[model samples]
Target: MLDFNRRLFLGLAAGGAAAARFGAARAAELRPHEKELYEAAKKEGQLTWYTGQYQAEPSEAIGRGFTTRFPGVEVNVVRSTSQVAFQRLSQDMRAGVAQCDVFSSTDHSHLAFLKQNERLMPYKPQNAAGLIKAAQQAADPDGYFQVTYLGLFLMGRRSDQVSEADAPKSWKELLDPKWRGKVAVGHPGYSGAITSWCLAMRKLYGWDYFKALEKNQPQIGRSSADPVTMLNAGERQIGAAIPSATTLLSISRGNPITMIYPTDGTLMVPAPSGALKNGPHPNAAKLFMEYMTSPAYYEATRPFFSESLRPEVPPPPGSRPLDEVTMITADPDELERDGQEVKELWRDTFGV
Candidate 1:
């Protein structure tokens, strides 16, 4: 059996001869044992990935990294909101078209639906054993889908512009008069992170929290990612609810931002990955699943500001480990049941 530990994963950072075939470039290497899978994937030469975990930019970057690591395998990334991606997959399946090789979504409910229908391919990778135990436990035990990415809705602020003394330390602080015009947030309807955050908030603080926030006139963006850009540009001093990954990624780029994990607790959502059962590129899809779970994939796509799946590769600076942070997760069943109702309430209260 081949080990997919940090050492082996790092070694495969530059692929073997198969990867070198593309150019004089440093190829993405596969394990000596994986040569067979590599050859098989080479035959398929392509895959289409549908994802709602990241926006187009980082999504494409991850795809590019995948192709770089495994030469001759081209990846076409189709990215949109979680619900939108799910709808696309449903349409393709219903139409009898195999348009996606893999599907990733921020909405946990989607995984349950796909798994129940037996639409997801079940081939657990050896690399999966290296994932964090908490996240691993959250994976579909039957192997229909696995937790691939994670993000949290935490407060963020322009550290340079917002003094530490004045910055909000908790979610309720954002409602203070001092933060009236300085706050920004993601729309619950469009962002799975925000949807989870809103749902969790309603459970913890009730709908009144959102109603009170409305009086502060918070600027609402489409997704949790938007507040990162908004805060970076100084359009808003504080992102009331943005992806912790987005904030950390920005700070890494030297943005004057600081992730503020609320005293109350943050809303962390774990996104899942699944290979489509009838995907056109089965071999590539399986291999890609291995890559997604491997440390090599983490090395290839560090821009993700991810909570490391494996303890070997730690999360970026200035963020608490998922286990260390105070987190509130929305129930997948609850989201499936009440997501629409929360979104409706959001629009009515915020008028966004």
Candidate 2:
């Protein structure tokens, strides 16, 4: 017992020493302001992130990258679809548990709702200035939230099943009887990206558009990323509103799927991240908000084909720049006001 105690003590001491050295080494890589933030964050030790941005793989990769750059601070990533994440966050809030430090959601309305309820911490990240104009425009004027991620909600198809010449060229093409039962889509009630896409479609083609789409009997998944999986598996030949980044990531893996920028316009989904008002790790949350806007965050996400928030960073290869694309964007105000109505409309139309 004595020997065991001595060994355990030595092991713990060595681990502590290694952690100290790692933190010091990483701190050397930071700028003065970042170093200062890192010092405070290190004291907090970790931050819990509730994200509906990327799926688990890329989300966890970003978390790991942050830890590598800020050694003493760990990231606890809780990933889910937008509505689900929001529901979980709501549960935490109602329980008075400060479980989530940072909340990143694909639904802009979520941030607006949080800001309105005063549940979000108002903080302007210094690195936010480096964001591109579009991202800046999407940020909350009062700094309750900032756009941290961007993706195009576009169409895609299984190359093995659909020929380029025969594939859909516009959103309207999916409504044709020829593609009935072959269309895949995500549930707006579950995914914020899908909610935005629904709004964009409603704006463009009216509620009759979804009424027409429903006639074709589309397969509905919980998350926008699920369409990519369905397309890859040949479970669905065409994805009606797949996230461009997730589609590109699958394509890069040699999946037999091809992204198709709808001739009408691609919907650009701006995902925002904000610190929680009653988080356990406020300093760490602030540090994370800063990290999300930094170039390192872009670098970590670039390989996954996520659109860069900073102008200095280029889009991934094979991905078109936002300026070059005919993009459709939703207003946060509209989304905040009509999000629930759209969700209900979707449920009424699809019976899901």
Candidate 3:
């Protein structure tokens, strides 16, 4: 009877111990990075990322990369035209919704507006100090905005119709009658990067130059990514003002396409990222910003045709060496003052 009682007690104790071990193992299933992300995200419960163009592809890549390193965290992305993203952010802000976490946009137009309205909070990413000098210098004084990436070229389908040597090397070359109606343009009103390109042309050549190009009758696209696809399909043999990624990705896929980094100059527009002032997931947004901006991680994950804000992150393959290209500089003040007027002019001229 004593032995039976002792055996029963030992069995019950071992079962309890087994249950405790299983619970502890289950708790550890959440990766450390995931635990960090989850702890930060629980305050907000969700994060909404609004970004420009191919941002979805890279953003998803980053999200997968993040999840691999840190399980248990999920990231949701809302990709659209920069104009659309800004409008949504603006609307949410005005309505007191406080829905989104991270706002990833190209150019300083939205950044200027966010600052002007005090809609952005000053929260630098954890890795901000390790950014390249250019990237660091481009960040807003109070950390309201930070430069993300710089793109430098336009692309086209490499049909026998255009020779690599004869590609447009200056803005003036694009207006040649032979290329008229053959070019694809993203509506400047909706694409901040394209708008920046137009603004850069205005600064570099003259306002009259844009007026002349308008007369060339370029076919405007809805999303910036559309032109790249159109060029890939050979529906439009030439892509106007496409950034490096569109063309390079197409070329790598065996699409007969080529990119032109205008010899006269290409604009280096910095896409700025920030957290909404009253975002739903402030902590999660900050964590994401840290993830996206980390020099080490960014270098490891950068697309083959893009430039990372980290000097340590090498320029993608087939890109013009950073030193060789003369990139037009943008003035945030000027962009803020004239973005609407310029966009209006673009609308009137292009009918987009």
| Best candidate, TM-score | 2
lDDT tens digits, residue span 159-201, model 1: 8898888888988788788778889888877777788888888
lDDT by residue for model 2 (1-352), tens: 0011223223223433443343311122577778898999999999999999998999999999999999989999999998999999999888988899999999988888889899999999998886655566668899999989876789998999999999999998999998999999999999999998888888888999999999999999999999889888889899988988889999999999988998888887778999999999999999999999887887788788876665545566677644455667676778899999999999999999
Candidates by TM-score, descending order? 2, 1, 3
How close is each model in CA RMSD to the real structure?
A: 7.6, 13.2, 16.9
> For model 2, what is the C-alpha lDDT against the true structure?
0.84
Give the lowest summed-lDDT range of ten residues in model 3.
Answer: 1-10
| Cα-based lDDT at residue 234, candidate 2 | 86
TM-score of 2: 0.91
What TM-score would every model get versus the actual structure? 0.86, 0.91, 0.84
Candidate 3 per-residue lDDT, tens place, 123-150, comes to 8875677565556666788888876655
| Candidates sorted on lDDT, descending | 2, 1, 3
Q: Stretches of candidate 2 above 4 Å error?
A: 1-28
Model 3 ranges off by over 4 Å: 1-38, 42-45, 155-157, 296-301
Q: Each candidate: what lDDT?
A: 0.77, 0.84, 0.67
- In model 2, pairs of residues that clash are none
